[model samples]
Target: MSSHHLVAVDWGTSSLRGALLDADGRVREEQSHPRGILSVKPGGFTEVFETLFGDWMRPLGTRCLISGMAGSKQGWVEAPYCPCPAGLSEVRAKVLEIEPGRISIVPGLNDSHDGVPDVMRGEEVQIFGAMALTGLRDGLFVLPGTHNKWARVKNGMVTGFRTFMTGELYSLLSQHSILARTLDTSAPLDEAAFLQGVTQSDNGQGLLHNAFGARTLALFDRMPTRELASYLSGILIGEELRTQSVHAAVDVVLIGSPALTQRYQLALQAAGTQARTLGAEATWAGLHAIHSTSHRKT
Candidate 1:
């Protein structure tokens, strides 16, 4: 591992990004492309990777660790999920080596809720990275995206987690549904309106009933069209929060983009919970940690 460099990649559905890291696990360079797995033709991953990252891999002994959809059945190569209760060591053990020591894919994690199955690909890396950065072996973590995830970790391992379609639902209701008629989707965040929706969600009427209020509020001019989008966003996110047992005494770690995390932070505050945030750096640290551990074992 002394002379070798690492190429850390996070290839998801809509885009791909990578970093060139030195032996010490510090990022030396970074780049991204809009060509995500969905955009690549079948069996064309090699071509795409080479086109986007060949220069970084040209140096001898450089290894690449790819995470996310790039390892899914629809991507370059299928890396089976590593079942939950997984830690860094468990994940490292299950990595699918595609080119011996030159490249490998980090397997995603699979968990179950009741009888329904839930899976996450790249979020596992971010969770581990958050742990590495925060020095907390156990806590609750939330990753907000198209599909928001709420994960619980104990003793440095993910015991289980749940997923919510909060973001997708917000998009649908705000853009595709009848509510879109009055929504100013491009309006900036209206904190007051958003919080109003959050509060409305806890009214015991449930989401199906609460969501419709967004349209009615706008129709009757009770709420401004410009703020309707934020209101709708709050209702969905607030519903997601309703499923969790957030305690004021406990802190939740949030890993995602600023916009999403900021919303989660505000919602959590309303629930009397504290939140800490980590961004893309968590993914890099998680990849580097696994790469370093795997190399040290050899």
Candidate 2:
């Protein structure tokens, strides 16, 4: 009936992570599984949840908050998205309760641009968590993943945002495209090649033309086969950056795994924009913040 302890879950499309937090919001234990929403059979979410995290929920007053695609139509429970210009209050108000006072799903955020709609599920929690951890009420936040998100926050509300298939494109190009033949996709990042791609993206020759250069560059011995993947990555991420009107004066925050965020940091810095990085902790803090607020309301 009370929320003296918390279990925060970020269950995405391909993977899920859970954190057990004490009353102080510090993580006490953590678990991860590859059983994302897609892996769960229809009507089997409860079983999956109980299988993975039921032990943590046995204590009295332990509440659980699930975020990400777990709230989508295909998820355990469909938690409708809260329209943009949303903050903790707006999102908290719309959370879908699957098990009253014990388990809930945090609603995602949606925004439209020129009649084109863009949506995100779990990234919103990371944004709020970043805000709570950093004490920043306003800034530009980017969550880099398979589909990267660029969100604008004003006075603690996400006013608008955009999504780019940067990572997905990189995957396709590096693994399935013609360029894949010459690319050692498993090679570690080559900063020089990556920055080169970033610089090339700014030459005003659009992505289609520049992306082809990856193949030509390797074909002509201009770039090594091992470095082609990084070069290609730079091009895609750079292309994603081309559309943003990033101001040098504004603060930029990057949230994701260290490896991914480092790539974005390099690309952003190449364009003269500096960014701060946050990791998985943001997700836990965000869910904890929402849980605390909801507990207060009760």
Q: Once superposed on the true structure, which residue ranges of model 1 sit more than 4 Å away at CA?
A: none
Compute the lDDT for candidate 2: 0.93
Q: What TM-score do all the candidates reach, one by one?
A: 0.98, 0.98
Error of 1 at 214 (Å): 1.0
Candidate 1 matches the true fold with a TM-score of 0.98
lDDT of 2 by residue, 142-191 (tens): 99999999999999999989999989888888889898889897899999
Q: Report clashes for each candidate as comma-separated counts.
A: 0, 0
